[model samples]
Target: MKLLSAFAASLLWAIPAQGQTDPSQAALEAAAMLEQASIALTEADSARDRVRALTGTIQAYEAGLAAMREGLRKAATREAQLTAELRAREKDVAQLLGVLQTIETTAPPVLMLHPSGPLGAARTGMMLSEVTPGLNAKAEALAKDLQEVQTLRILQQNAADTLTQGLSGVQDARTRLSEAIADRTDLPRRFVEDPVRTAILISSTETLDGFASGLAEISEGEIAETDASISDRKGDISLPVQGILLHRAGETDAAGVTRPGLVLGTRPRALVASPTAATIRYRGPLLDLGNLVILEPQPGLLFVFSGLQEVYGEPGQVIPEGTPVGLMPGETPEIGAILSTTSDGTGTDRSETLYIEVRQDNSPVDPESWFRTDKDG
Candidate 1:
């Protein structure tokens, strides 16, 4: 029995820690993504289309950071589970240790001798052989659990640095993207925006419905018509930004205000893009809805997005699908806050909200019906 215990201990000690042998897949993928984003950033400086290149870099960084956050969350959850299991088996472990110690200290001659005689001693030896394998298996399993707990702790500690780099890279990409958009004057124009008419329209309208109904009055020239029609693609479009659906249209808020729009919970400074190729009918501050961008995908259809910190593109420019439209307003959480929130599993990291409203033929429609809501941000 003592020999068996020693062998088990040696095997356990020989087993490598899981973290050293098999790092978290999510973490590895995230690191790869971040590395690619860094390379993209460097290449964007010389790219012919800096806006497009920077946009891709920002997206890569976002994906990497999201993966890292998920990896940390899983690691934290696994660590907690292992800790709890260890605590629950504390008495069992103590008893197992005591048994091992007793077997180690006992003299082999005495252990082999049975009071009944040679027959009892032979039976006892058989019983010991039968139990040894079970004990060794349990000991090895326990060792693995303990090692995994230690590994998870190390993984989380190392995640902070990777997350910081990802966050910094994304911010830099966003800044460059903004500069690129500003310097861009090559996008096709549908019409020149008449600021005076647009102001009059805003001043004259008290609600979104009114403003949208009069969108045609602000164009200074004949609007260039495009064949772009998303009518067949209704109910299959992606959301303008990566986020969680907070509230459906007509859901009342804490302030008791109800509006016909879908509310999305997004992270701070999250990128917002156009889901389809559309002409920018309007882009600016309007009413009490911070910064807004209105896109006319077709003559009778309009997509309204509000609660932005920065808006992109000219009022009458025709932008391609997936163009960066704006950014959500809020300070990015620090590394410590992100890790704390992830471990706590409160999902409070998404602190900003984006409001989306879809209108067809001058009537409000459920945004959910038009946008795919099953995807994770």
Candidate 2:
């Protein structure tokens, strides 16, 4: 019996622990996306449209980073739960180890012969037979948990390098994209911008409403009209950037100010695009608001985006849907900061805000009604 117990323990130790649950799917997907982004970066250098190519690369990096962060958060949470569970089961584990030690040390003849004679020995054998399975099962479960904990730790350790590469690749792509946009001169323009009129309008208008109302005054010539209309897609338009809605239209802010627009919380340097093909009516610093882009998707509908660090495209040029318009203001976080935020799961990495206001025929409308607020990207 002692030899049998020893053999069992040897077998348990020799066999690798098989986790009951699958590895994190999010982590796997994140790795795949990061790898693709790496490949895309290499291919972007030779692409015909460098701007579009770099844009795709940047998007891939963003998705990979987001997924990686989520995966790390889950791993951290799982590790904590397993640690707590193991601590709680300390007594059970100690008893299990004691039972194993006692079995290994006891003489087979003495273990078979109980104090009360043959009947006692038979009862003891029966009890051992029933309890042995439970012990083995508990040992297996413990092994699986330990293995998972080790795996999670290794994943987190290796994630730092992967995140660093992803962040660097994305920044490089953004720089290349900006240069490509600057060199771009093929886009068609509907009208020429009169800087003097624009300056005059800015000086004269106190509110956004007044500035928007006077946009036509800044046009040097007749604005070529297009039949472009997104009325069919009203109430279902995707947001121009990947972010969470921080404040709703007419909601009061910490500064005791309320506006008829939606504020989006986004990660640093997040890309802002046009949700639909539209004409750029204005693109510059507006009263109090930072760099802004005002797009007219249709004759009566205007989509205003504010709080950009750098604006793209000339005013009066019509850009297609998903065209890169601007980038949010802020610097990319360090790997340590990213990991800390991931472990905390507080979503504080979204440090930049983008203000979105939709106007219909010179009247401000609820941006939530026009945008799908449920989407994160």
Instruction: Tell me the whole-model lDDT of each prediction, alpha carbons only.
Output: 0.84, 0.85
Candidate 2, residues 1-377, lDDT tens digits: the string is: 45445444543423334564344667777978998999999999799887778888888898898888888888888888888877876766676667767866889788879878899899778766765775677677777889889988888888899899999889988988989888888888889999999999999989999999999899899899889888888789999888878899999989998999989999899999899999999998988998999999899889999999999989999887888999999998889987776835555678899999999999999987778888765
Off by over 4 Å in 2: 1-25, 101-111
Over 207-298, each residue of candidate 1 has an lDDT whose tens digit, in order, gives 99999999989989888877778888889999988788888899998778899998998888999999999999999999999899999888
- Per candidate, the number of residue pairs that clash is 0, 0
Taking every candidate in turn, the Cα RMSD to the unseen true structure, in Å, is 4.5, 4.6
